[model samples]
Target: FMPASLLATGSERIVSGLFLGTALSISSVKIVAMVVREMNFMRRDLGQIIVSSAIIEDTIGWVIIAITIGIATHGRIELASLAFTLAGVAAFMAFSFTLGRRIVFDAIRWTNDTFRSEYAVVTVILAIMGGMALVTDLIGVHTVLGAFVAGILVGESPILSRHIEGQLRGVITALFMPVFFGVAGLSADLTVLVDPELALLTVALVAIASLGKFGGAFIGAEVAGMSRSEGIAVGCGMNARGSTEVIVASIGLSIGVISHTLFTMIVTMAVITTLAMPPTLRWALGRLPMGEAEKKRLEREEVDQRGFITNLERLLVVVDEGVVGRFAAYLAGVIGAGKPTTVLRTSGESEADPVEAAHLDEIEKGAEQGREAAKEADEEPAHEAPLTRRTHDAPLSAEAVAKEARKGYGMLLIGLGRAVTAKGGFSRRLNEVAGAFEGPLCLVLKPAGVGRQMPRLGPGSGRILVPVNGTANARRGAELALAVASVTGAPVKVLYVARPGRDEPRDTVSHRRREAVLKDIVALADRYGVEIETAIRSRAAAADAIARQAGRNVALIVMGVARRPGEELIFGETTSGVLQRCPCPVMLISDARLRRDDEGREALRSGTGTG
Candidate 1:
């Protein structure tokens, strides 16, 4: 069929056959990934294999396609040309995954943090993709390879937020994808298939493609220890060619490697296979039952997916270069791991603000302390988001924050030198700080002498304490505590303070509720691979119990509480009490947005000011 099809063109049948085989064998990564994601099977084990295999097929297929493209560009297939293209591709991929990887991440992070313009990061991403595509074309390979590689690199960037990802995804899915496939459809004259001979060829082309891909995937699955039914499903899943076929045929047509009739046949085959794929793959996927292990893993992944801190897109740090500022830097670095963070450095408190008068000496030393803490944070994993320090010459104010807020930070973290301000100690600064952002908040308060001791902190191999209630905020705090503990290999102590009740021990009064809370937090710690301990304080106030635990040589105290809207950042009496007397530094984390009603959210968005 290959020789007969190419007789008019007088091209080498063997080379044309190689191109046809490569094109037919490749599956569409975009098409398959979209279907899998739509079905919500992305985290399933079988789904993982199918998508990963398609990715592998796309990669190998592109390398082969690049070689052929190189031949077509030079008007002939030759050994020297093939080897040169292969060498160029090899070098390109090696450099791309290495230095190119770093460059791409840095470019995206820098653009995201440095620019205040809307969609600036999205524009930068598109530029990176186009730039890489041009590089591949200049190196005598297909630009498709560069574009595909670029997508992979961009997808892997830690700083890539859900909002940005979804935005890019929308453009591709709604506009570019439809346009590409629509253009392919318009270019393909199915009228060529009206001839009996060409119609027969299209049918044969689909059969050959379907069988070869199915057989290859089926055998691979079986060899990798899947059951017979699983292998059959894998074979069915791999049969789709979709857009990959159209793109390959288009490329071949443009380069004169295939005549118009052959291009039409390929496009017809693509349309048929793609149309038949969804129902077939869906049926096969439905037939495969989930194993116990897969179920548990998926459930755990789902929990992590919904977790508050885990989903944070970006962090805003407002601090001075003071002792407490340094402490906030360290905590932010720990929690902000992988999260893009912007630092707002207020040089010092204004002399007129009562905070400066209350803690004049301490405020003066904060800037130096913040620098050292930031330096220590830099010592953590380099793959995490790059911290951008926004230098401020004036005292921190809501208006300065309102400008950065336009850049879309998802959380606000405030750490300053003085615990008290003229407005009312801690709550005033928090009230002023949280006003500019419509997201969650974290407040890091330094204990009296913790500044001098902070340089000695944050290799955190000591015990960490977290007080847990069954509330969402408490769970979030426990999760954050577990994460910090996991990084430092510290043991976590879960405390539940129970007051006395009628005819029962104080701690025993709420034994059932305390047990449930402990159970949940312990599971959370297990997920993070951190050790956890549980305790109950009989007949005690929550603040007193937490403070006593913190006094027990605890490395850090993490309290999760909801923020209440008031004239200022007054969380509650218990939280305030704990902060006032706790000997160690305490971290107060809140999920203000989670509890907001529609009206409240509108108020927040309009900057009517809720913490």
Candidate 2:
């Protein structure tokens, strides 16, 4: 219907109507993103479909508009011109997704490490976008497609997708978006409505575009297994042709594919249709009830949105050249894959010092191995983001570490010798270091090497042991353990320490409490797709119970402990004893007080291995 009506509108300019029609048919991504976010349905099933379809529509619409203009310039859609348009588009898309994807990811990662300066990555991304846009223009397609593809690649780079998003979003929202939209409005003359013939033609044009877009989206939804009601809601939601339509019309006018009269009509149609969308979408969405699966998925995503480890952007490792340091590097590698990481060795030794050099080498080796493990598991890309081999020879003092910590690191991984004193109290030096940082800390503890254990299983895979005692610290420990296990696809054991005889007998009450704790841990592990085994040990000492349970199968033990004020991280007896005697490595995840003001970035303090 749209094609026939467009054909009927012109004799000399047959493809002009086609260009205008395509421009009018596009649904705006900016409009859909705003409305869905305002309604807080951005993560809903239908909402995602609508946004995704808009992205596709925007791409396809630009391609069509570009080609139609080319045909209009040549005065005819010759067979050769048609073939060239099809081939150019196909080749452009193929290169964008394949080799272009790799080049973009690698360039972004390289820029981050080489410059080591702020916004180096942002500079690289913009350059890539501009270069790609020029390439598209040279190929006779619209620059918008190139810019759009560049955005996809930039978003995929894990170095700082979140940080980059925050930075770019602010710049675009505060400056670029308003300027562009405002200029578009200024260029559109609404006085064209005074001409009755043009006004009637404009009305007909809008009607054809609206009905066609609405019907196409509705049919697509139904074909993709959505209900009839969902199809209706999607159609209503997609009727907006706001900013994208305006941009398309502006481009067409500049290229002579559309006249001032047609551009004004299209812009007016865009304003009317866009204004009509939000309320109609709200009403339609209000009638579409949420399903159980969607509700559960959204709830899970909400939990992740608030989670600590889930949001960690970068890592800073302050360690010594020891078994603990190498192990710390390994953990950081697994957890910090595709994230910027800086490793600092505190030995304060010269490059000539063999021990210092060996420790640094070992730490980097372990980190590389861990990253490989993550890559094999498809957890993240290897050698992307801040994959640093640059270890500073600087002193591991609070002043030294804190200076680096202030430079945009979210988590600090501290590994050291003598974390616990002879009396089972945290070493004063550890506290002094940990006191400097206000961010969360992961203290890596190297376990006692009691017996020569057998090496088995695949690379980066290991069994993790976590002790649960219904404490917040314990939950944090289990959370960390679950994350590691999830990344490495390792098995986890959740051991509950039941004292020798507390008289909380194995009756229904005690049993139920124990059951609840284990159930919670199991559920947490399940969320990460990690396999877990639960156990209860009626033992005299919690530390001894946990230590004894760390058999040959367990590769690491993660303990969560609260920090007691004064001078040290006081874990009472259980944690201190675990540090003293456990045969497997113990990682203590402590919730440091995270302070922040109005800015989105976090304030971090210097950290030590005791916490």
True-structure lDDT of candidate 1: 0.74
- Candidate 2 per-residue lDDT, tens place, 278-348, comes to 99889888888898979977866675665666677878787766555655766776667556777777652
Judged by lDDT against the true structure, how good is candidate 2?
A: 0.72
What stretches of model 2 exceed 4 Å from their correct place? 1-12, 38-40, 72-89, 114-120, 289-296, 315-409, 412-439, 448-464, 468-474, 487-522, 530-555, 561-574, 592-611
Task: Quantify all predictions' global Cα lDDT against the true fold.
Answer: 0.74, 0.72
| TM values, all candidates | 0.80, 0.74
Model 2 residue 361 lDDT score: 52
Candidate 1 lDDT by residue in tens digits, 183-213:
7777778787788877877788889888888
Worst 10 residues of 1 by lDDT: 355-364
Off by over 4 Å in 1: 3-12, 35-40, 191-196, 222-229, 275-296, 318-323, 341-385, 389-405, 420-424, 427-434, 447-463, 496-518, 535-555, 592-611
Task: Check candidate 2 and list the clashing pairs.
Answer: 436-606, 437-605, 437-606, 438-605
Q: Against the true structure, whose lDDT is highest?
A: 1
